[model samples]
Target: MRSTFSSRLRRHALLGFLAIDMLGLVALVVDQVFSTDPVYPWIIAMGLVIAALPLLAQAVDYVLSTPADAAIVPDTGEKIP
Candidate 1:
């Protein structure tokens, strides 16, 4: 159950980032071609930053939630029987 939720969060966060990046790109082009205002780019940047916040928080939580020792890969350098 826990893993499912964790995976879901990661999936959603990545999707959100992808969406924000694509939208920002589109907005930049639109602003350059159709709009004269420069604020649109700033607005897109702010949206990206805001969208990143939850992803950052969730990433930190995901890292911290795991056991410290688990982060280290075991040495497969020498196999001891």
Candidate 2:
């Protein structure tokens, strides 16, 4: 696949995951406000997964897409031999 295509797909996937995380956050808040002791742990667990999915996706995408020998972010200030 072309780099542009892959990058755009990654961007959209991350955005989708982020939306899920945000919704999970809302769920957590709503649950907290309404109920007392039953759903909090479950909501928190789901929230953690939702929050981590995007970051995990990003790391996987970067590792799979990038060359193993290449630096993740190049040093822009100066280069020394």
Candidate 3:
């Protein structure tokens, strides 16, 4: 199946968040090892918040796409007995 632009955007956003989180972690480690006054802990926290944006976007998308009265069905083809 071909992916839509929104899906691509979401994926890219998630990847960007991951990159930022990784950079923040590396900076935190470097700061702790070298500096007496640390500042990158806030960067880590900001990274966490940034990571959550993709999740929040996903949740909003799910809520918006699903119909209010939609039936719940398992992906497995097995019928309920």
Candidate 4:
């Protein structure tokens, strides 16, 4: 059971990474195509933020689901809310 849960978490993490990377790529393309000025920094920052959403979400989930006694553990063992 724990193995299955871990597997699911791994899969979700991979998907999240891909989703973030895609969003970053899209943002880069959009900025390059539409902006008149060199907006690479802004685009990169936006991309970073977009990419970070899933990670942030996961972190929040972990935090919320974690029991007080296991707060120090990297991953939450409880069911997500």
Task: Write model 1 residue lDDT over 2-79, tens digit each, in one string.
Answer: 989988787677656665666677678768776867877667666766767666657656754656676365557755
List ranges where model 2 is wrong by over 4 Å.
36-81
- Please report the candidate that would top lDDT against the real structure: 1
Clashing pairs in 2: none
Mind giving the per-residue lDDT tens digits that candidate 3 earns over 1-81?
A: 355777767666766666566667766776777664566665665666566766755754664464665465545786865
List the candidates' TM-scores in order. 0.44, 0.43, 0.42, 0.44
lDDT of 2 by residue, 4-52 (tens): 8978787777766666766666667767777767567567756666767
Rank the models by lDDT, top first.
1, 2, 4, 3
- Which ten contiguous residues of candidate 2 have the minimum total lDDT? 63-72
Worst window of 10 by summed lDDT in candidate 1 = 71-80
Prediction RMSDs, each to the true structure: 9.5, 9.2, 10.3, 9.0
Q: Would you list the C-alpha lDDT of every candidate in the order shown?
A: 0.68, 0.67, 0.63, 0.66
User: On a 0 to 100 scale, what is the lDDT of residue 22 in model 4?
Assistant: 62
Worst ten in a row by lDDT for model 3: 66-75
Model 4 spans with C-alpha error above 4 angstroms:
36-81
